[model samples]
Target chain A: MMHLLKIEWLKIKNYKAFLFISLFFLIGIFATNYIVYSVFHNIVNKSDAALLLSNFNPYDFEHVWQTVSYTSGYLLMLPSLLLIILVTNEYTFRTNRQNIIDGSSREEYANVKMMMALIVAATSTLFVVLTALAFAYSSEKDFSITGFSHVGYFFLKALSYNIIAIFISTLIKRTGFAIGIFFIYMGAENIIAQFLDVLSMKLKSSKNIDFGSLGDYLPMNSSDGLLSFPPTPLKSFTTSSLPTEYTWIVLGFAIFYLVLFSWLSRRLIIKKDL
Target chain B: MNVLSINNISKNYGKVTALQNVSFSVPRGSVFGILGPNGSGKTTLLGIIMDVLKATGGTYKLFDENPDNQLRKRIGTLLETPNFYHYLSAVQNLKITAGIKQRGENDIERVLEIVSLTNRKNSTFSTYSLGMKQRLAIAAALLGDPEVLVLDEPTNGLDPVGIAEIRELIKLLASQGKTIIMASHMLDEVEKVCSHVAILKYGELITFGNVDEIFINDDIVEVASSNIDQLKDALNLMPGNLKVEIKGNIVQITFPVGSANLENVNQFCFEKGIVLSQLQIRKKSLESKFMELTN
Candidate 1:
C-alpha cells in the first residue's frame, strides 16, 4: 500500500496544477492583509485608539493567523477542481487506459489521486498558517498575538470544505457540473435555513427554532462560519445561537462524501476496457 | 504449463457482443500471436486477460493460478498507443507508472535505453513524436521486468523503420525466453515472429496451430513447355505425389505437401523429351493462405 501511494505521489508531484494551488493561497494571505489594512487604517485614525487596534500592533501572531486561515477561499476550489481534472482527463488523455493495461487496479489508481489531492489540501492549509505567522511577527514589535482557536477554526473549516470538494469532483468527472452542484446545495441550505428562521419568528408563540445542533443547518448558516452574531433581528429572523454541532455536521458530510467517491472510483476500474 | 490462459471468457456491451465463448492458451516462452482484423474481440480478450475489463462468463488462469492475484507481477503490457502525462518529462511519466506497479527501481533508464529514448529522457512527453510516444509506452510496459509481455497492435501507427525497430526489440525479448502474446492485424509480422498463432474472426476462433502447420502445404510447379500437350500427356502418366494441368502451352504440376522431389520430377520430364522452357516452385505465403481461410 505504501509503495503504491509513493508511486501515485511521484506521478502527481510535478503537475502544474499542484504548484499553482500552493502559490495561490500563499500569495492570497498577504494580499488580504494589504487590502484590509489599506481600507480600514485611515478610518481608525479619527476614532478611539484602544477601540481601533490599541495602536500597539494589529499585525500580531493572532491577527496574522486569523487573516491567513480566515481568508483561504482561494484554495477552497483547488481540491475539487484538481481531483476532477486529474481523474476525468484519463478518459480524454487515454493515459488512464494505459495504467489499467499495465496491471493497475482502478482502486489503486483512485486511491493515489485522492491521496494526492488531500496532500495538496494539507499543504495549502499549512502554508496559510505559516504565511500568516511569518507576517504577524514582522508587523509587530511590542506584542504577540495569542489564541490559536480562530486561525485553527479557519484551517479546519477550509480543510473540510476542500475534502468535500474533492469528493464531489472525483465522483463527477466534469468540472463545471460538480461546482454547479456545490453552489446549488450550499445556496439552497442557506436560503432554507433563513426562511425557516423567519417563519418561526412570526408564529403565534413567536419562538425561534433551535437549530442548536450540527445535523440540519449551520451556524449563521454560512460557509465562512460565525465569530459573532447580532443581538437584534432587523428582519423577522432570529434563531438560537449555532451549536458547534454544525461544524461536525459539515465535517461528517465531507468524510462521508470522500469515502463514497473513493468507493465509486474504485468500483469503476473493472467496468471498462483499456 | 501455459504462461497465459483464458477459459470460456465472454463480455458484452449492452446488446453488442464483444466476446463470445472465447478461450485460448499461450504456452510458456513462446511468441503467441493473436491475429484478427479490427473489432474482432482481440482487444477485448487482451483487456480481460489484463483484468482491465471484467468477464461476463468463465474464468482465466495465468502462470498456473487465477490471474487476479499473481499475474500482475508476472505480466507487462503495452495495450495501446499511450495515456501519459504530457507536461511531465519522459522520466517523470515513467516514475509515476513505476510507482503504481509497486516495484520501484531505476529501470526507467533501462527501458528508455531499450526504446532508444535515453537522449531525450529529459524532454516532456508532449515533445515526443508519435513513434517515440509508442516506444515510451512500451518502455512503461517493461518497467517491472515481468516474465511475460502482452502487446496489442504494438506497431499500430509506426513508420516502417519504427516498426522494424519494435520488431527487433520484441525478437530480442523473446530470445530471452520470455512468453509474449501479441495481437496484431499484420499477418506478415505475425508470420515473421510468432511460432504459434490464433486467428480470430468476428469473435470466434477461426484457426489455431503452429506456424509450420498453418503454412505448410503443396508447392506449385509451373512448367512452360515447347509442346504443352506432350508435357501434359507425359505428366499424366507420372505416378506418386503429383497433380498435372495444361493451359496455353504451359504444363503446371503441384506436388504433395512437404514433398521435396522437384529434381526427380525434372529428371523425368527431361527423359521424356518434354523440352521444358520455364520451371519454378511457388510456395504459398501466409497472406494468400489467410485470404483463403477468411474468405
Candidate 2:
C-alpha cells in the first residue's frame, strides 16, 4: 500500500492543478477561519448588539473547536473538488487503463484511489485542527479539548465528501460530467434536506413526535449535520423548540454512507471495462 | 512453455457481441500476430488479456499459470492508444509507469533511447505529435525488458520511415527470444514480422497457426502463347495442377503451395508444340488471402 501511494504521489507530484488546488485548500482553510475570527473581534465585539450576548467569545478555547470546524466545513468543497478533478483526470488521460496495463491489479487501482480519499480527508482535518488551535490560542482562554469531537466530525464530513467525489468520478468517467453531477447532486440533496428538516420541526411541534432532524438522515447531510456553529446566547434562546440532535444516529448514517460509497466506487472499477 | 494461453474467452457489450469463444496460445519466443479487420475485436481481446477489459466468460493464463497482477508484471503491453498524463513530461510519465511495474525505475533512459525519444524525454505528452505518441507508447512497453510483449496495432500512426524502424525493432526484439503478440489489421505488417498468426473475422477465429501454414500461398504459373486454348488444354492434362484456366491472353495453372515446377511446364509446352510468349510464376499475395478469409 505504501508503494502504491508512492506511485500515486509520483503521478500527482508534478501536476500543476494538484499543486494549485492543494495550496488553495490549505490557504482557504486558514483564510476562512481568519475572516470569521475578525468578524467576531472587530464588528461583533464593538457593536451595540454585543449586549445581547453579554461579551461572549466564540473563539474562546471551549468554543473554538466547534466554531472553526463549522466555518472551515464550508470550504470542504475545495478539497472535494480537488479530489474530483484528480480522480476524473485519471479517466480523462485514460491512465487508469494504462496503470493496469503496466502492472496494477484492478483491486490496487481502486484501493489506491480510496486510500487517496482517506489521506486527503486526514490532511484536511489536520489543517482544520491547526486553524482551530491558532484561533483558540489568540483568545487567551487557556487551552481546552472541549468540543474537540467536532473536529472528528469534520474529518468524517471530509471523508464523506471525498469518497463521494471518487464514487461519482468512477460512475461518471468524464471529468466535466462527474464534477457537474457532484455539484448538482449536492444541491438537490440540500434542498430536499431543508424541506425534510422543516417537516421534522412541524411534526415535533404539532404531533408530539421527534425523530431528530429528518434532514440529517441523507447521505451528504448525515455528515454535514454533525458540525454546527458554536452556540451563542441568541441561538440558545431559539433552540428549546427544536427537535433533539440525534448525534449517534447521524454519525451512524454518516459512517454507513461512507462505507457504501467506498464499496460502490471499488465495485465500479472492478466490474466495468476501462 | 506457452507465454499466453486463452481458452474460450467471450465478451459482449450489452446485446452486441464483441468477441465470442476466442481461443489461442502464444508460444514463447514467437512473434504472434492477431489479424482482424476494423471492429473485429483485436483490441478487445488484448484488453481482456491485459485485464483492462473483463471477459464476459472464460479465462486465460499467463506463463502457464492462472493470470494475476504478478504474472502481468512480467509482460509489457501497448493497447489501443498511448495513455499518459498530458501534464507530465515523458520522463515523469515513465517514472510513474516504472513505479507501478516496480522493476523499470532505472531502465527509463534506455527504453526511451530505444524508441528514439531521448531528446523529447523532457517534453510533455500533450506536446508530442501522433507519431511521437505512438513511439512513446512503444518505449513504455519496452521498459523492464519484459520477456512477453502484447502490442495492439503497434504501428497504427507511424509514417513510412517510422513504420520501418518499428518493424526492425520488433524483429530485433524477436531475435532476442522475446515473445511478442502484436495485433494488426495490416496484413503486410504481420507477414513481415510475425512468426505465428490468428486471423479473426466477425468475432470468430478464422484460422491460426504458423505464419507459413495459415497464410500458405498456392503456386500460380502464368503462361502466354500464340494459341491460348492449346496452352490451357496442355496444362489441364498435367496431373499435379489444381486448376487450369485461360485468363485473357494467357493460361494460368494453379498448383498446391510449393508444388509449381517451371521447368516441367516449359518442357511440356514444347512437347505439345506450343511456343510460349511469357512464362513466370506469381506468388499469391497475402492481401488477397486476408480478403478471402475476412470477406
By TM-score, who's the top model here?
A: 2
The digit string of per-residue lDDT tens for model 2 on B1-295 reads 9999989999999999999999999999999999999999999999998999999998998999999898888999999999999999999999998898999989999999988999999999999999999999999999999999999999989999999999999999999999999999999999999999999887888889999998889989999998788778877887853698888998888889988999999998899898899999998899988998888
Runs in model 1 deviating more than 4 A are: A37-68, A131-255, A269-274, B102-104, B221-255, B260-280
lDDT of 2 at B133: 95
**Candidate maximizing DockQ:** 2
Those runs of model 2 whose alpha carbons end farther than 4 Å from true positions after fitting are B225-230, B273-278
Decoy 1 TM-score against native: 0.78
Interface RMSD (one decimal) of model 1: 2.3
Question: All models, DockQ values?
Answer: 0.44, 0.87
Residue-wise C-alpha lDDT for candidate 1, range B250-272, written one tens digit per residue: 77687767664668778888999
Residue B246's lDDT in candidate 2: 82
